[model samples]
Target: MFKIFKLKENGSDVKTEIIAGLSTFMTMAYILAVNPLILSACGMDFTKVFAATAIASAISCFVMGFYANLPFALSASMGVNAMFAYTICNSMGYSWQWALTATLMEGIIFILLTVTNLREAIVNSIPPNLKKAIGAGVGLFVAYIGLKNGNVIVADDSTITAINSHWFTGTPLLTILGVVITAILMVRNVRGAILIGILIITLLGIPMGETKYAGGSFLPASPYFCEFSFSEIFTNHKTLSDFIIITVTLLYVDMFNTVGTLIACAGKSNMIQKDGSIPRTREALMADAVGTTVGAVFGTSTITTFVESSTGVAEGGRTGLTTIVVGILFLLSLFIEPIFGSIPSAATAAALILVGGMMIEPMKDIDYSDYTELIPAFLTILMMICTSSISDGILFGILSYVLLKAFTGRIKQLQLMTWVVAGLFVIRIIIGILS
Candidate 1:
């Protein structure tokens, strides 16, 4: 293991990698419960979905470790799964099987792009500010998601969101307390501060009627063994146009998160090539594509490299060994679902909010003095948080950048790839409206 993972070469050993892995897992382990809770609305079995989540996450991390040789980890994605469970499965009237089918198809498309050089072209074309803005945007988006989950914010009749003044009630109070304690831990430079916050809040909530508890078997059937039948690919007799749109939506959204996570996490790890490209670009991206396909087969929503993996990188994980350790932890999650599931959303929300806080350092790299870079970058951050869609934010940013450059007589300076992406974004939007 030492020779294979290059413990000396990467300046990381078994102990350090293990600590980093556990830290990363603790930060993202909320997905063990949150994913099932969200997907259960689609009639998925909670125990089965939990197992699938753990398996998919493990597979993705292993692929990243052995294939990409990066400290990145993967799991069922937050934004895409919300769209998958709520928008596609529930609101759009598609069965969960059909949704997985669309996700599987998207994965295949991502793989094709990786093999064909298109993925590299697209990744190379994105400007630096826009990429940093994508990271900052996801930070805001994650924070927004945490607040929404905690009921710290709620829908308003007039304004889209407003502060929940009734937060002193049941769970929201615990959420506020969690965030405060988590912040204090971070301020004191506590090691594994996020995980410490999660545990402290969880323990604090047990006596307050906040965390739920139920007695059952300590172990559940692994979805790897029991849940295969539910997520097989299936297609309805719906209009071809609707099917096409959903497939495209899934593909675009997955790609957005994958690329954004790659760039942000790589930047944090100082793993970027001198030419401003990520090392092992194809293998890393292919791991994400493979993760999505395998996740669908395992009976779960779309899987992708998670932005929360930055938490591991921040903990001084330098090479694939960190990811390998994470893979082991995810597999262990299968046997401990009951304990993880008992923790309330508020506790997990605190961790996500703190992770977001660490992610904003990228925004400092943006060229805020230049309007050409600033406008598009600002739009990317704004639309991502407001619309809760990373792909939409990137699309608007690219299109606006292209148009502004063209009208400002700087079109000649733009790369051909930018125009191609703008065209694709335009076509997707037209199809969205027409269908």
Candidate 2:
């Protein structure tokens, strides 16, 4: 394991990797509960989808660990799952089988793009400032998720969003205390601080009545294996168009989701080189590509590299050993649902918020005086928080950068692939509006 992952070479050891893996898993375990709920609403069996989520996540993380040798985890993406259930299956009147078919096509396209190095070129073409912006934007996006999940922020009728009125009470208060505890631990240079905080808050929640003991069958049901609807998808012209659009949307979303997350977490881990490229770019992309294709076959949404992996990186995970640990835990989760299920979201929310705080350090590297650079970077960060979509954040950033550069006679500074990316975003917007 040491020779394969080069723990010493990556400045990480087995113990640190284990703790980091635990931290990553703690923050993302909510997906086990959430993904099943979302997919089941669209006619999937809850228990089967739950099992599929766990298995697919384990498979993806294992690939990422052994193949990419990165500390990242992979799972059915939250937003892509929503689109699969809410848009493709629910609103569009397509069956869940057809949605899986679209996900499969998206994964295949990702593999082709990765093989051709188009994905790598697109990633490398971004300017350094925008790269930093992606990291910073991810920070805010993550923090926002933490806040919502913990009920630190609540939806309001008068205002679009507001602080929870019961903030001093149950879950929200526990989340706040967890943040303070974790922050103090961080200041003291404590190892496994985030993981420790999650555990501490979970214990505290037991008395607060926020954590409930769940007693039921732990066994997972069988998935709808290989149950695709290819004939239904290709039956007629209108169905074919819908299939194409659904597949394209999934492809576009997962592409940027993977790219933005890789860039953000890579920046956080100091894996981005002086030339602003990540090592093992092909292998990392392939992990995501293969993960998605396999996930669709297992009856789930598109799988992508998770941003929550940043929590593990923050805990000093630098090697694939950490990813291997997460993969193992995910496999274990299938048989111990109640154990993982009992941990409240409030316990993990604090860790995410703090990691968000840590990720913003890259923003200082941006050249503030260059409006040409500053505006796009600023938009990238702001839109991510406001829109709550990584792809949208990157789309606005790239479009603004290309437009500003072109209008200011600095178009020559942009790469050919940058222009190509900008054009693709434009096409995506057109398709979105038409659909």
Q: Can you list the residue pairs that collide in candidate 1?
A: none
Best by TM-score: 2
lDDT tens digits, residue span 1-435, model 2: 789999989998999999999999999999988999999989998888888888889998998999989999999899889988998889989999999999888889999999999999989988999999999999889998999988999999998689999999998999999999999999999999999999999999999998887665777566668879999987899999989988888889999988999999999999999998999888899999998998889899999999999999999999888889998998998888989999988999999999999999899999999999999999999998888999999999999999999999998999899999999999999999988
Provide C-alpha RMSD values for all models, in order. 3.1, 0.9
TM-score per model over all chains: 0.89, 0.99
Q: List the lowest-lDDT window of 10 residues for candidate 2.
A: 215-224
lDDT on C-alpha atoms for all candidate structures? 0.79, 0.92
Residue-by-residue lDDT tens digits, candidate 1, 18-52: 76777678767888878988998987777788888
Lowest-lDDT window of 10 residues in candidate 1?
A: 225-234
Which residue pairs does candidate 2 place in steric collision?
Answer: none
| Candidate 2 deviation (Cα RMSD) | 0.9
